[model samples]
Target: MRTLSGDLIAHRLSQAPAGALSKRLYDVLQTAIQQGAIATGSRLPASRDLAQELCVSRNTVLAAYEQLQSEGYLQTRTGSGTYVCEQLPETAPQASLSPSTSSAPFNHIRLSRRGTRVLARSGAGAYQWGAFMPGVPDVSHMPHDIWRKIQLRLSRRMPVEALSYSNHGGCLQLQQALAEYLRVSRSLNCAPEQILITAGTHQALDLVAKMLCDPGEGAWIEEPGYWGFRNVLAVNGVELLPTPVDDEGMLLPDLASFSQLQRPPVLICVTPSHQYPLGSVMSLQRRQQLLALAKSAGSWVIEDDYDGEFRFGESPVPALQGLSADAPVIYLGTFSKTLYPGLRLSYMVMPKPLAARMKMAHSELYRGGNGLAQLTLAEFIREGHYAAHVRRMRQLYSRRRAALVKVISDSLGPAFLSQQGNAGLHLILSLPERIDDVALAAELEQKGVLTRPLSAYYIQGTQRRGLLLGYACVEEQNMAETFAPVLHCLQRRLSPA
Candidate 1:
């Protein structure tokens, strides 16, 4: 066995004579580390030094080192030398000498729970009305045939590189298409380099959470807001402050001046175009104020434009990121709401400087979503299918929303208060006083009408009792029939007679 420079010795493969010993060395080192022979925190030799000691080519040493790294046996710290990862398990013998275990009561390390996350219960697979669904598009009438043709054509003409991870920033064609689409449609003033394609809004949120907010820094969230946003912030260990939201979205004046507060938020997340749960779009006047405040405070404003593509009436409001002069805002838009949520395609528009860092983080995070899907979507957006599709769905959803509104008015009466946010898939039907929304929803579920309660979206005091009803998926003809029973259930629960 040839001893390597620092601490490694080659484990001899007596049976096999090998010319390229790097592959064998890599496997041996990996097995040693995994089996705990080479303990965690142990350092390996420099590639050049190890090569000389082992009497092998520098390439062989380099190859072996890289293989160990890719397999997670060793981790490279920026500027610091490669060390055996703390992620690597230690041998039982090493544990015997540990002061904590040897001197104190013995207990096994729970790898399943410790150093790992237990995913919080999400509303996945559960059919609940009005929960902030991560990915559900008004796919009631998307032109699948057209999309399929585009995908087929793209696949045929696509370079072999398209089959592999093309670029960390995402597909170039898609980025170009998105940039052009945003400029005219969204009024976003940015180029393709500013966009970092991501796997839906969840990944976008997670990336922003990782990038801007340090642990314990405040990330101001809306009270009674979309739970997923709060969940992302919460799991990241951000100090969350729930600001109140009322008739207008995000109650700008209520944003507790971070300067006045000791722990000022480094980041602020808001669904400005259309507030989730309550479904109130932040007014144009307040949009300016939010930008001014975020600029003044020098905090990054994360505008999650989830359902911004759908505006059934009036001129489309300008994106807050577009309106803002300070380049601190990170704009997030996803096809989950605009197209099919199952597509799992979304993008983040970054300020120039942040884009470079975001790209570095992205490659480390996920080399980007599937290259094939990105290619398909690129053609969809490039050929004008995306915009045309949204226009059709917007009209379709408008009819369903109107139908839901009518059914609520007639069956539940005008006495039950409601939120008046137009241009989203769902709306909140505020209930009368003294009715338990959660309990009522359960009763409604048994009647085969699944509706969401506003109480569940709340994390603070003074939560309103109501149901969140999504109209996008329901057919305009069936909207009345589908909502009739739900409305009756809410009415019967609140009746005084």
Candidate 2:
């Protein structure tokens, strides 16, 4: 039996802080065993000897040993000293199981082409909430108290059916509430049966991509549009055709031009309410034209109305789906901006003909949960709290947007120009043609400012140089202070050294 020297244990224990002697001793010994400094099956010094060497009471050493034994780090033998466990608990450090020289063969694993593309364009930053972090709403102001009360009420009053797996679309209450709300607010014509609840817009897009288009079919996405839309379509093996966006919105290719191609787009996605990054509302004329084109081409339109609720203009524009009676448009909306992102509740108003299949596919692809939350949100909208909250946030976001615009004009001067459109929570600051927006964005991030480079949104052709700055989560009072770092970074970069 090999015995561990009291001197070696004392040396290891000496490095630990002066805490409860037993706990400190236990931690030190545990780490030693985990690191393989103490070999398995080696007998440890007797409690009295270790206690004397470490200058701790024998009772403390005994307590430490007892803890180690209970935790499976040490094994006690009848009429024998405590020994390091031969078979440590499953929670034992993996490093202790093998020689340090061995390496994992991670390079041998192969990812699909689709997976590789998805990873290549993952521009999501580590930090999502801060000054000028685009697309995030002011979740700090969400009505948590009211939401919690509703959640509790639903939990208690809900029937047993609410707790089980929901094989259908979603909670009927939410669908009905959403149907009524959409009719009045967004002019969306939909029955309760047509609404399908999803985790968020990404899942909605994924389902639509799967159902409407086959693999290798062409899908038209707005150039300089939402990256989430691009990635989701790419991962599903759909060929993405980047259609350019002008002041009016997506500039659709002529039908003759599409006919020339071997595979024309069967799916067309647009943020007609407020075009992402460069907030341009699709003109009424263009909306009709696009609808007519889609109807003729046998194409399905996906209208992402994300953040349309908080439009800061005269009046919110009606959704594209409401423009015609049987328009082939899937209207997508989410509570992430109005309420909170963590809620992860979004819905799509599907056409009656395609509704059943999409719902079944959604259920089969991703099973639904969070029934209580859906029920609570249904009550929230039914009781008019959702509308009330939207009104309040609209005023708050408008004020913050104005403050940020003024700060940018004052700080950046003619060097940067704010782009068009007064709707949506973010503003685009167009940079000088020569300046690299990506590098500037990186510098700004290091100084505690978050902004998305406009160039990153473009997939083809000449990319615009600008920054998308979100002001919804930023307060009017702190706007100047929050923008100071960005101004400093810009000044430092543009200054003649």
Candidate 3:
């Protein structure tokens, strides 16, 4: 408990005019307790005496003190003066529970104990690499003013019911909008009935895994794939059968290399449009073959189209879902890369039977996706803002990709083989036999150039020596300046012997 005159409280309250005097006083005292400025058992002044000292009415002091007492910030026993509460220190937003492993099965946030190093931008760090961060969209490019206005306008005008927990599937309007968008862009043949809104592609992947995989069962995850898939699958106890990927993409024969589980493989996780880490796009012939293999093996293909929208060179490739007319293919895509990461909106195109299955699954955990954000995004796509954004981003990403390629080629000088798919934000720089790719990535990080080693994405072995460098987040005008440091890294990695 702490003693303070009403005059002292008045001086403290004047700092935050937006907040009430009582609230400000309570906050000041609360922070003092948190910082250990006021130790336990300190006594506060009597209301009447504090009022008299400050020349304020007794009622004002009483009301402020009384509010604090009721809220458990202060304690007042019969005939006892006010004292600070002995409970936990106060905070605006109470800290979330420490990731408890024993409380519940699903209460944990699963992350890999191996090779799961995210770059500075995604982690807790100060200096930024300008704006070039992987898996991040330029939020500054988003129509924020228009979106805020829409949110405000909608909140004021819409019926209260419209703002409540929406339809389990998603908003009808959004589903309709997505159905239309998918048809045009990805060549996905489905109506609003087949689409389900998820927190993002990560959620979509988790849900599919939950519905599809039994513990200790097998799932084919592409080698040199996204680390997110590994984290999600490991958390669910799905035994990952790491299928190796060459230039052609996921090798069917190499997947047969791993020991089979009790259950047959349930899913084949892939990034067909652009393989993660390696940045190799799966060929159309291979896509058909992979679907046929999945069909024969009685497994589903989980298409992780994380960056389906940003493709350059030729026309955008049709998704594997489009190829799988009869086969069971769960198509996953996200607006996180297309929009901003904070939006946390992704969708899935499921087969009818699986859609019914997920309905039951989401019923248990996921109540529903964000309604207002979904609704506004639906409008954005329907009115063609999304398409325009993708087109603009494609051009920008292409330039950055080219810049990365040129710099790496010049710096490495014949060690690099420029791969084909000039579509996405990232590209792979092939390494020679002598240098370990992982060590090279660490070396680059020391020089203040962040790049992901392709080996981190691999499970068992047979990963090519390479590094995945993202340029989509980099500014076109600043590519030369940004690539300068990276060029030095390439020189160091490419040095003789």
Identify the leading candidate in terms of lDDT: 2
| lDDT of the candidates, in the order given | 0.74, 0.86, 0.71
Evaluated at residue 3, the lDDT of candidate 3 is 38
Per-residue CA lDDT of model 3 for 334-388, tens digit only, reads 8877778788888888887777668667656687757778878877788788788
Which should have the higher TM-score, number 1 or number 2?
2
Q: Which stretches of candidate 3 lie over 4 Å from their true place?
A: 1-132, 253-263, 443-448
Q: Rank the candidate models, highest TM-score first.
A: 2, 3, 1
- Models 1 onward score TM values of 0.73, 0.82, 0.74
lDDT of 3 at 126: 46
* Each prediction's RMSD to truth: 13.2, 9.1, 10.0
Going through the candidates in the order shown, the clash numbers are 0, 0, 2
What would you estimate as the lDDT of candidate 2? 0.86
Please, what are the lDDT tens digits per residue for candidate 2 over residues 393-426? 9999999988988888887774466556777888
Residue 303's lDDT in candidate 3 = 89
